[model samples]
Target: MAGKETKKGRKTGLDEAAIRGLAEEAVFARGRAYRDEGAVSDVVRRGDTVTARVEGSETYRVTVRIDAGEVDDYACTCPYEWGGACKHVVATLLTLIEAPEEAQERPSLAVVIGSLDRDALARLLLRRAEIDPGLAGWIEAECAAAPGSDADPAPVAAQARAVLAGRYAERDYWDDYRPAGDPAELRDLVDKAVPRLEAGDGRGALGILEAVAEVFVEDWIETSGGYDDETLYPLFQDLGRMMAEAALMSDLDEDERASLADTMTDWDAALAEYGVEDSFALAVRALEIGWDPPALQAILNGEGGKDSGTWPPKGEADWTEGELTAVRLRVLDAAGRHDAYLHLARAAQAHAAAALMLVRLGRIEEAVAYARKAFGHPDDALALARALAEAGRAEESLAVAEAGLSFEPNESVSLRGAHSVVPLARWLREAATESGRADLALTAARAAFAGSLARADFEAARAVAGKTWTSVRRDLLKTLRAAERAPERTEILLDEGLVDEAVKDVGGAPGYAVPEAVLLRLMEAAQSSHSDWVIRVARSRADAIMDAGAAGDYAQAAEWLRRAALAHESAGLIDEWSATIEALIERHRRKYKLRPLLEALRF
Candidate 1:
C-alpha cells in the first residue's frame, strides 16, 4: 500500500501509508500521540537513501533514513524518545506525499546533455576539440555513438587544422586531409571554438582549451587553473568581466588594443548598470599589460569620476605613495629584487598582505626583522616562524612559534609552537648525554613528555617519539645510572628485550618470569592474529618442557592457553578456545606425569 499513488499531482515512491504505519507503531510504543497539526518539513534523497524530516508546530527536526523498500534507521533531534521514533518521520512522510517527482533520479551530466540536438552536438564537439585537442578523439567517439546521430564532421575538421598548423605529427595522414583552407582561418576558428568552454558548454570548452594548451606552453595550462574554469559557467557573466580585466595587462599596441579597451569600458559601464561594484584589480593586471597602475588607481579610488577635469592625471599622486611603494617592494622581491625587497620589507609593517608577500618572496631575514617589532600582529609572527621552520632554523622557529602562542593560547600559532617543543626537548637531551650529564638527560626526557602533553595531545608525543626514538632511548638509559626503581621504565626495558637488566632490576611481579608460551600467546593476541605456525610452535615447546617434568613450565603453558581462551572469547571464537584448552591440558598431563583433571569440554 505504501508503494501506491493516491493523487495525480502527488509524486511517486513507496506508500505514505506504510511509512506512517511504521512511524505510528514506533510512536505508540513510546507513549506519544501524533497531533493533527504535525507537518512534513523536507525530503532529501542521496543515492538510494532518502531522508525525510518531519516537524511539529514547535519546529522540531526529526530525520528518517529509508533505503530501497525498507526503513533502515530513524533519528529525531527532539526529546521524544527514551530511545524511540519522534514526529520527524511523520513530517518527512507528509512531505513525500506532496512532491513525488522530487524523489526521481538525481540531476547528472547525462540528463543535462541528453537534451541537446544534432546541430548542438556538432557545435559542442567542434568547440571542445579546438580548445583541447586531447579531447578531440573522445568527443568524436561520444558524438558518433550519441544515440542515433550521423555526420562525423569533427574529425575531418580536426585533421585539417593539424595539417594547416604545421603540427601534422602523423605525416602520412596529411595527404588524406589536405586543407583547402588558410592557416590563419583555421587558427581563428580554433580560437573562437575555445571560448565556448568559457560559456556554459563545458565539454566543448574543455576540448577547445585542451587543444590550445597542447599547442602552447605550460604557462597556459597552469595559469588556466587546469581547465577547472568550466565549472564556473553559472558565473559566466562575471567570468567575462574578470577575463576583460585580465586583458588590460596585455602588451598589445595602442591601435590594435583600442577596440578591446573600449569594449572593457562598455563592460564596466554595464556592470554599474547592474549596480555591481568592480573592485577586482588583480584580474585587470593579469589580463592587460603595460597598463599605468597610477592612472588605473586614480579612476578606481574615485579621484577621476565621469566629470573629472583630468582623465586619469599624468603626474600627481595616482595611488598613495605608501601603498604603491609597498606593492612594488613586494613585486620586486618576487622578481628577485633581494636588496630592494629587504629595504621595502621593513616599511611594510602595518600591511599584512605585503608582509605575507615578502615572506613568500624569500626575504626571510627581513620578514623576521618585522616579526620582532610587530609582535602585536599574530599573522606577522606566524609568517616569520613558518619562514624560519622552512629554512631549517629550528631554534629560531621554536622561539617565534612560542611568542605567537603566548599571544593567544588557542590560536593555530599555539599548535605550531607546541609542535616545536618535541624537537627542542630531543636536542637538549642529546646535548646532556654527549657531555655525560645522565641526570640532565633523564630530566630532559621527563620534561619533554610533560611539555608534549601540555602543548598538544598524545599523538604529538607519539610523533616526537617517532622523530627521536633512538635519542629518547639513549636518554632513558641514562636514568638507570641514578639507581631509581621505575616499573614504568622497566616495562620499556623488558619490551626492548633488555632481559638481563629486567631480571636484576624488576623482580616483583609474576609478570616478569612469564614463560615463552605465555609471551607468544600475548604477542599473537597483541597483533590481533591466531597463527597456526605460532600456535603449533608454542604447543611443541610446551610438550617438550612437559616431558621434562617441569611443573612450572606446564603451569605457564596452561596459563598461556587460558589467555588464548580470553582472546578467543572476545573474538566470539569460543569453539577454537575449547580445542586450545584440550591440547593445553594434555601437555600439562605429560609434564606432571598424571591424567588431566578435566575429561571433556564444550564451547
Candidate 2:
C-alpha cells in the first residue's frame, strides 16, 4: 500500500522465519540501510491479501496477493523500480509458504474439464473462442493431438489460454520505469488489442496496438506452447479483416494513414497463407500499392542477398582493434569476469570503451575499479564516473566527477552526467519515500538539478523532467506546500508520445538549465556545429539511439537520433544527416508505422 491501507491474507502455511531470512538477505545484500531498524513489524491477513510492514530506520510496507501458492501482484514504495520486484516483494513471497486450505479446495479448471472427451473438449474450445478468438486455435490443436493415457488436452489448452489472458489482465502493474523492455506487457497488449478491435474502435484499438511487425519475427525466435501458424490461421484471418478495415476507414493523418497502409500490406501478405483473399485484397489496395509476397519473402529470407563473403565479411571483426578491445572489456565486466576484462582492456589500451561496457553490464564497482586503474585516460575516467552514477554508487560517482574537475576543471565532468541523474534520482526518491525520508529524495532531486545546471545551458536540460524522476521531487514537495493538487503522473513522456516536449521541459527546470540546452536552443545547432564535430557527435548519438531502439527504447531513441540528425545537417553534412534521418524514418515506420521526417516535410 503505497499511500493507502495494507491488505491482508488468510494465514495458512505462512512461514515468518523463511520470509524474514529472505527479506534480511535481500536488504543486506543490496546494502540497504533501512533494514537494520527492526524486523517484520506487522503481518496482517485479509482474504487473498498478505501485507507486511517491516520496520527498519523507517517502516517498509509490502502487499502480496497470493494465487495458488504463487505471488500474483506486488507493490512497494521503494526506489527499487527495476523489474518491479524489490526486497519487500521477495519478503512477502517468502512469507507465503503455501496457499490457504480454502484456496486449494476451490475447483480448478482441471477438475471441471478432466472428464471431458475429445469432442466435448472441442465444444468447450468453441465456447471459449466465443469469448476470445485466440483460444479457438489452441482448443482445436488440443482436440487434434492424440490423447495420452493420463493426458487431458481440453483442460490443458484452456489453462494455457487462461494464463495468456491473465498476463494481459495484470499488465497495468508492470511499470516502464524498469530498464529491460516490457515485452510481457507488450504481448499482453497485443492479446487485449485483438479482442478490442472486434468492437470497431480503430483509434482506441490502434492505441493499444504498437506497430511491432519487425518484433513479430523476434517474437517467434523461440518456439512457444501455444498454437502454431497452421492451427492459428483463423486468428490471422480475423486480424487481416481488422487491418483491411483499419486501412480503408482510417481517418489518420498522412503519416499515420501510411502506417495503417503499411499494416494493411503486412497483414495482406500474412493472410495470404490463410487463403483469406477478400481480406487480403482490401488490405493490399488500402496501401495504394502491391507486391508479390513470394518475391518479397524470398528477398527477406536472404535468398536474393549479395555474396556472403563480400557482405559483412566474417571474422575480420565487426569493429576496429580499439573498438574490439573496448567491446571485449565490456563483455568481460558484464559477464562478471572483472579480472579478465580489466587486464585485457588495459593491455589493449581500450579503457574508455571497456569502462562504458562495464557500466552497461551493471558492474558499477568493477567499473570504478577499472577507472581507478585507468586514471591515466581522461575518457576512461569519465566513463567510469558515469557507470558509478548509473549503478547508484552516487557518492563514489560524485567523487570521480569532483576529482576530474580538480585536475581538469572543465564542464565535461558536470555536463557528462546530466542525462544519467534522472534514474538515480528516481531510485533515491523511491527509497526515501518508502523509508519516510522525503528529505533524501529532495536532496537527490536538488543534486540532479545541480548536475543539469552544470551542463553550461539552462533551457535545454529541463526538457526531460519526468514526473516520476527525482529531479521533480522538489516540485512534488513544493506542490504539497502550495496545496497545488495535480494528478499523480505515472506514465513517462514518451509513453504519451510527448517525448519531444519532454526534452524541452526538462531543460527548462529552474536550476537545471545547462549550457548544452542553451547551445542547442538555436534552430540548427546540430548542423551549425563544426563538420568534424557533426560527424563524430551525430554518429555517436545515432549509435546510442540505435542500441536503445534495439532494446525497445523506441521513443527515447527516436528523439535523441532526431537531434543528432539536425546537428549533422547544421554542419553541412548532408549525406550523414540524410542517412541518420532515413534511419529515424525507418524506426518510426516500424514503431508507429509513420515516417516522421516525411510527414514533417511532406516530401
* Per-prediction tally of clashes: 34, 39
Q: Against the true structure, what is every candidate's RMSD? A: 25.5, 25.4
In candidate 2, how many Å is residue 65 off? Answer: 8.9
Question: For residues 1-603, could you state the per-residue lDDT of candidate 1 as single tens digits?
Answer: 345343333223556546545543335322122323435434555444455444454555544555655667665545353443555655455445544554443444466578899899879878877888657654553353232344233553554335334432223433442212233433443344323323333334323323332332222122332232221222333333333322332245566445544544444454444343332222233334333555444433345345332322334423333333433443444345454444333333333444455566667666556566655444445555556666766566555544553343222211122133444454445544555555555554555544442322222233435556677655545644353444344344445555445444433333434434234434444423433323444445445545666542444444344444455666676788677667656645553332342223324
Could you tell me the lDDT of residue 469 within candidate 1?
Answer: 62
Q: Ten-residue segment with the worst summed lDDT in candidate 2?
A: 485-494
Query: Tens-digit lDDT track for model 2 on 1-603?
Result: 011122233334434443433333334223222233224446555555667775544557776766654456666544454443666565445433432221222333566678899999988877778999656554443343222222233433343344433323322234422112223333342354443344444454443332322223223222222223332334344444444444333345667766666765665555444354433344434334322234322332335334321211234332222232333333344346564544454444455555666677676677677666655433344556666766777667655543443233222211121234444443444444444555554554454434333221112123333444554544543432343221211112223333343343333322123222232332233245333443454345435645454432333334444555565555656676666566556655664523453335221
Q: Residue 132 of candidate 2: its Cα lDDT?
A: 92
Q: What C-alpha lDDT, on a 0 to 100 scale, does residue 107 get in candidate 2?
A: 33
